[model samples]
Target: MAQPNAQDDFAKLSADLSTLRSDVAKLTETLAAIAKSEGGAAADAITGRLRYGAARAEAAASGLAEEGYAALQDAKARAQALGGDLGATIERNPYGSVLAALGVGFLFGLLSRGR
Candidate 1:
């Protein structure tokens, strides 16, 4: 379950990244068109501003991607650790684990009644 959720999260992240890349490409093309269609100092100034804005946006996107990658790594590590711990606990007390599972299921059933 954890693996499936992680995969889904990665899939969503990949889709979002692709969308961001496409948007950046479109913005770059638009800026280029504007710079080409106009002339003189005003056009130069606009191009400079657009370039600066694009650079900042690219940097921000890069930072966000790095952060997301780090978070995903952390989540994967935590999930692995949790799975190990749960396995150890169940191995140490199979009957306890079974009882706990049953209790949890019973509680869920009670809470979910008529839903």
Candidate 2:
């Protein structure tokens, strides 16, 4: 007996909410179509802006990668041009290399130990 009034209120609220959601969906679709049409300088300006943004992003990414590769190549060239056989240098600098190797090996050992 007491449930009917509460149930009626809940039903009305649900219907109102449902109608509002449908109206918003229709508005979104209408705006999307409008933006697609009406081509002119305004449209061209938008297209140009989008293209410029995409090109700038692409250029930045490529420039960063090229800079990194160039730095690596320069470092390799410097090592080769230092006027000593790399193998002989390693042999002469065995103590330093061995210490570095041991440190690296310890790190790898710890990482693998967890697995």
Candidate 3:
């Protein structure tokens, strides 16, 4: 058999290099596609977690609001009952209440004068 020429060998080497470059380009495209898919999946998972956390937070805030409203209502009821009791007591002893008020004012005036 005749031996291959130098030009033939050079041409074969160039062809192999071109084939290698094409294969590398295809591999790069495939890897990029896979990474994009995985990134989307990861983002979806994070979004789900965030939504769950937000829902829990909202529920907790709603519970706290209910508790606060109950406490305020209880405080208002107590204050109203105390006011009625105070009014009855004042009506029953208007003269005594006036005397007590005058005494308190006199004491406060004396204290303000540093005497």
Candidate 4:
């Protein structure tokens, strides 16, 4: 009787182990499927966001470039206007312009000597 009882217990333990293994395998399969599906979706979402960000950056750079070009054009126009004014002034008062230049040169010499 004792031997028969021990055999019965061993058989029950084997069945329990088999069931546990089957449950573990099913769980592993479910996890793998979930990871595969979710990983692809997450990757696609990240790629979309990156593309949007790149587009925004490109637009911002283009806008800044346009603004810089406009500013350069304005600066060139102003410099040309100032050059014309200076040329007219020099032509109108050559002697005064020469005297001013001599004075500026003297001042520069004095400042440079100190340096």
Candidate 5:
């Protein structure tokens, strides 16, 4: 049996990770936007409590998930600082990054639509 090339395996894994990161960023933006847009007082309070729970979850995440979350938050901050859209990020890296963002947005849309 032939063995897989280690470098190729790593590259594929890295791409998958990048896509996942982008997806999380999109979801974060979508959720934040949704929170801003579709909320009465009760919904606002619920979101606030959910955010509080997120802080606790952050504390519990540990290791790689924590690092991923931190990177996600950084990506989100950068997006918001640049008006929170695709243009800037896409201009920097055309294919992978933008696709990741789209994947994230798609996930967010599906989840939000369900709710």
Candidate 6:
């Protein structure tokens, strides 16, 4: 067979290089597609966790609000009962109540004098 020509070898090399460039382009596109898919999945997982945390926090806040309201109602009832008792005592002994009030005021004044 005749020896291979330099022009023929050059043409073969150019064709091989073109095919390699096309393959590299295809590979880059495939890698980009895979990365996008993975990123989307990660985003979904993070969003799900955030929603779950928010729901838990809302429930805890609602529970705390209910407890605070119940405590306030209890305190109000006790205050009303004490007010009724004090009113009855004062009506039965008006002069004694006035004397006790003056004594308590004097003591309070003495205690707070330093402050």
User: What tens-digit string does per-residue lDDT give for candidate 3 at 1-115?
Assistant: 9999999999999999999999999999999999999999999999999999999999999999999999999999999999999889899999998999999999989889953
For candidate 2, list the clashing residue pairs, or say none: none
Clashing pairs in 4: none
> How badly does each model clash, as a count of residue pairs?
0, 0, 0, 0, 1, 0
Best prediction by TM-score: 6
RMSD of each: 33.4, 16.7, 2.8, 2.4, 40.3, 1.8
lDDT of 2 by residue, 1-115 (tens): 5566888899999999999999999999888777766556678999999999999999999999999999999999888877467667778999997898899999999989954
For candidate 1, lDDT tens digit of each residue in 4-27? 688888999999999999999999
Q: Lowest summed-lDDT stretch of 10 residues in model 6? A: 106-115
Supply the TM-score for candidate 2: 0.36
lDDT of 5 by residue, 1-115 (tens): 9899999999999999999999999999999888777766668889999999998887777666878999999999997887746667777788888689899999999988943
Error of 4 at 108 (Å): 1.6
Span of 10 residues, lowest total lDDT, candidate 4: 1-10
lDDT of 6 by residue, 1-115 (tens): 9999999999999999999999999999999999999999999999999999999999999999999999999999999999999999999999999999999999999999985
Which candidate has the top score in lDDT? 6
Runs of candidate 3 exceeding 4 Å displacement: 1-4, 103-115
TM-score of candidate 4 relative to the true fold: 0.84
Better of 2 and 4 by TM-score: 4
Off by more than 4 A, model 4: 1-4
Error (Å) of candidate 6 at residue 24 is 1.4
* Steric clash pairs (candidate 5): 23-104
Residue 50's C-alpha lDDT in candidate 5? 100
Compose the digit string of candidate 4's lDDT tens values, residues 26-111: 99999999999999999999999999999999999999999999999999999999999999999999999999999999999998
lDDT (C-alpha) at residue 99 in model 1? 100
How does model 6 fare in lDDT?
0.99
Error of 4 at 67 (Å): 0.2
